[model samples]
Target: MAALRKKPRSPFWFACFTLPDGRRVQRSTKETTRKAAQAKADGWEKLSKERAKARQAHRVIADIYKSAHNKELPDATPRAFITAWLTRRQGELAPASYAAYSGRATHFLSWLEAAADGPMADLETRHFTAYRDALAARVSASTANHGIKLLRVILEDARRDNFIADNPAKDCGLLKQETDTARRPFTLVELRSLMGAADEEWRSMLMFGLYTGQRLGDLARLTWANVDLQAGEIHLRTAKTKRFIRVPICTPLMEHIEGLPAGDDPKAPLHPRAATSKQVTVSRQFGELMAVAGLRAAVNHDASKKGRGSRRAVSELSFHSLRHTATSMMKNAGVSPAVVQDIIGHDSAEMNAQYTHIESKTKRDALDKMPNLLKP
Candidate 1:
């Protein structure tokens, strides 16, 4: 019911009424007479009622669509649907992938704020466009583009399940990757300098990276159980790719391993501190090592802070660059392309993208021919 009340010392009556959305608000009728004020209030209330009824009518149309199609319509909001989807993907996606997907999804929900509470079907392309642009402005193009790609995949799954009629993110193309920050393989001289500057564990890690072309995360988490001394191989399932590969233990790596005393527990980490360290921690430590070797300048905290909200400069050399170096050195050694591809390459086949069905002997031959990193 609409009611008329006087404000502080006003002669005019104010009409207080509830909107269709359930918010109570006051509006001045500008009428001093009671009769005129009551009439205006009644008229406003009637209009709000009509609007509420119209909203209900649209809801009925949804029910009608479901009845006509013999299927139930999805009533989940963006938050609800995205949360459930992430829960379902926990087991399906790799740890790194799930972490990334969850982070981006969470970020999207935060960005949406109140809109996240709306129906999943209500999302439009503008939402994705705004999000992509915002992310790009705050982060790097590669990061924003990767998030967009992941969001597209998530929404496409939603569309297939009838949560949405179409994927709004389908049209949001990825940004161009900034090639200036692209990582390059380390030169042999740079590699030698880094090795000389590093401690025992870091030196071993570099050797593994240069010989096996494995990522820093994988190397940091390696245990004795992952090594087969007799078989001359290092068995590991890569953290990011979830690809199980048996990397041949090169002569230099074998020599390095042979000098170390074996541990009783197979589960014991080869590098105790590194095994427990987070990937970023290991990376930062390596960055410090790079500074010591004069391969890169010391990290400046103030400069890094000043660069917030913008893409910070990335060095062309890092621990991961050793993977590129290993690949480059193998090719330069005249190893066959097919053999090199099998050794450090990902399978292009979508279904078996995590599995490489290459011969062990061929990969071993490729590693044997790789120029010795320690000698030169």
Candidate 2:
């Protein structure tokens, strides 16, 4: 092969060539040194012939992108694409979902800023693995996994937008963390003490949670609109699960709801008028109520505070545990798994939309156990 030389005009080196049209052409080797450029020039000659044949098929751009997969990026930077994705997600996701996504994205950006090389296209699996390991060291597995999940979503968007040819996160193989499945049921002793220790209003909320199996988010937003006095049921259209559930109002739960402070206006909320406020406000007030109840559930004193101190026996408990308590009690009272799923509004499988097949008789039996919840 003839030796090649670097072109003085640009960093690209080229070699002299001839076309079938008898016109002269110079192929860019895009390499340095005579010998390397010469070999690259030879490869270009072969590619030129192939391109001429493939012109009839009109697949040049496809060929170029596929061959240059590692070399080129789409029009936008990774950061810019991520920002756009987040903005689009703001309108698509629920408020709680948006908060979680935004929080995770913020953390991801912080990690990227400290990276040796920026942009997702430039990242290899090693980069993602390192981030995962670092997160695992400092945070719980679930927290780290949430960060990975958010990053994966952003990268998947990038892939779809042609910002990258492939999603680096798709095969990142993050370490799986074991999740604790233990039911955090509030004991009867704990429940009785907490109820007596609290004022009437909060005591009612606690009993309502224990009986209804409704989540804190759902229970906070409960109003007279969701109750059916004639049917003796509490009707709930859950925002998180996007399902409508109607649980029969047992004596204790009904008595609690009936005794709640009510305004003269029938249209007003059954509980304190503020339960329908933003999530943070409701949670803060609930935390105060828990303290007043002599409950050991820890309140978020300061968002800026860090470090996991040794948790008290009940300190690890949260307001969310009330829902778990309800679920556990239902199971203990002979509620079928299927009816439990329906009451909790949890789909049987993560990716499946179809609910688990549960017999109606089993469901009725499970619901029958609701009144017995007062025992525990």
Candidate 3:
């Protein structure tokens, strides 16, 4: 039985109830009227009684199973399992990694609910394949492949935990990615033109990119402490790889660094605006700079006609091209592949090969070194 009562000096009514175990619970009904308070109390009492009965039944069944097998079975719907798994992973993974996992899992579960019309335990390989194909149609193949990879990881964990009989995403193949459309290396002429056109901060960043071959994100967040003018080297820990590298400063870069105003704080970013602004904002500003330099055409999208997916098409030449330019120039200048790899901090030979661009002249010169046994 439940009773409705009002606390002294309080307008709202309270619902007081006792469970089958004689545990009393009191909760504010949040109602001022006696009739409404009585109705709420009655509802609470009914819900408590039903819960008590369910618990009692569950305990009786557990006791029987325990007497027979001495084990408790794990039971949860797909949604419940995934939600709990994601919560556990939130503490284990990096912020960015957790966000990616959460987004993909949430989206897939929503789709699963509509497509399978049942718990996640009933999912099959065909369903995952269908989902992958659907995603590939909606987004780029690379993006679709990322979703598939994430789903495979989630299902593999589920299988390991005995939550699911098998991993449906195990056999699901990644969509075939299209040929890479990565940015090309900027020509020497174009590099010179860009440096001439850039303002002070942009010019400094361009020099750093050309000299260090570091990513934009890493260079933008560079601090005064990282620059060792005495040793003529810059020590950087890459943001993506977390690899610490020491790159010797070139004469040009040194001159530029010397020209900048000295800062008292070693922790202060060398380029304040680049460090503070969002990445997209900086990229867009760089695109505008490209337009100003006549390297790329200016784009104007109509506000009224723009759709949600509409975006400015990527320019052939952008800030990232500076990295390629650095790699290519070093190779062209007769620098050994091993030395270039060390300077650029490439982890593997394969990745270094992708960045290296040997000119026709350089290739021909290397060919000339071969013995003239063919002529003999």
User: Can you write out model 2's per-residue Cα lDDT over 45-104, one digit (the tens) per residue?
Assistant: 665555344332323453465468964233345555666788888988988888878877
Report model 2's TM-score to 2 decimal places.
0.63
Error of 1 at 239 (Å): 4.0
Ranking by lDDT: 1, 3, 2
Of models 1 and 3, which has the larger lDDT?
Answer: 1
Model 1 TM-score, all chains together: 0.71
Candidate 1, residue 32: lDDT: 98
Candidate 3 segments exceeding 4 Å error: 1-118, 122-139, 196-199, 278-318, 349-376
- On TM-score, who's better, 1 or 2? 1
**For model 2, what is the error of residue 189's alpha carbon versus the real structure, in angstroms, after optimal superposition?**
2.1
TM-score to native of every candidate shown: 0.71, 0.63, 0.60
Supply the TM-score for candidate 3: 0.60
Of 2 and 3, the candidate ahead on lDDT is 3
Candidates arranged by TM-score, highest first: 1, 2, 3
